[model samples]
Target: MTASPNRGLALTVGAILAIWGILGFFFAGEGGHAFFGNEGGYLWGVFLVNPALCLVWTLLAAAMLIGGLGTTIGSRNLNLLAGVVLLVLALYGLLFMNTSANVFALNAVDNGFNAIVGFVLLLTALAADRENLRALRADRDDLDALRAEAAHG
Candidate 1:
């Protein structure tokens, strides 16, 4: 009930890495499991694909996602950790999944998602790289006082 955005995003990243890792754990017999009709299998039951690394990635993402949510809901720094993880994973996805033609179109879609997530995380990390938060050279109160003084004083 009312989960934070970081928590939601963490779940998403966790799910992606976890599912992919678990799926990798399952050995596919070439020809794409015969059920879907492709010719791709997870291969080596995920051992060769660096299952451990995927797990690490998931754990990092979990922290960062939660942290990011903390930042969003609490303070700006709450999600810095999560943002880092997102950036790393985005790069990882781009490096590992982007060029792969093994999984048909799935890899492409995943890579696209990875790019989006990474970019968003980068923005969050950079605080949108905002030039300023103030509306003008002076504060609102100052502007209001000026206006009031000009009008009555």
Candidate 2:
């Protein structure tokens, strides 16, 4: 029942992504070029800070945050899946930087950032799962030891 260390990592990452996505819209401006570059196009400088990309990031953030809150196997599985999907999307963006084939305003900088973020999420999820398993095994061992002591005494 203890929370995984990676749960904090997930929450942090999710909050950051969610905040960035939300702030992106405000800074986008009417011309869609307030913070770094313009929007409404497939590519913009080295960032794909479009509304669609923002929305996607926000949703992903939400999923990660929510998944991190639960201590169930299902929640962990969902987190793993989300991490994989994020990594795939980042890889796709990197592979097709010049094209808008995936409907994402991808660029080397943004995609590279995405890749790092995704990698972190994936690594954290794996670590969390491993920790959870270790905890379970320890619990079982403790129970076994207790039962043995009870039987002997």
Give the Cα lDDT of each candidate.
Answer: 0.46, 0.66
Which regions in candidate 1 have their CA more than 4 angstroms from the true location?
27-49, 61-79, 89-111, 124-153
Candidate 1 structure quality by residue, lDDT tens digits, 1-153: 223444445455555655554555354333434322223354333222333334454565555545544433332243345455555655665555634432222244444554566566545545532333223324666989999999996
User: Which prediction has the highest TM-score against the true structure?
Assistant: 2
The lowest-lDDT stretch of 10 consecutive residues in candidate 1 is 128-137
Put down candidate 2 lDDT per residue, 51-149, tens digits, no spaces.
Answer: 767777788788767866865454556556766877887887777656546455556776777788778767766766686767877998999999999
Q: What is the TM-score of each candidate against the true structure?
A: 0.39, 0.69
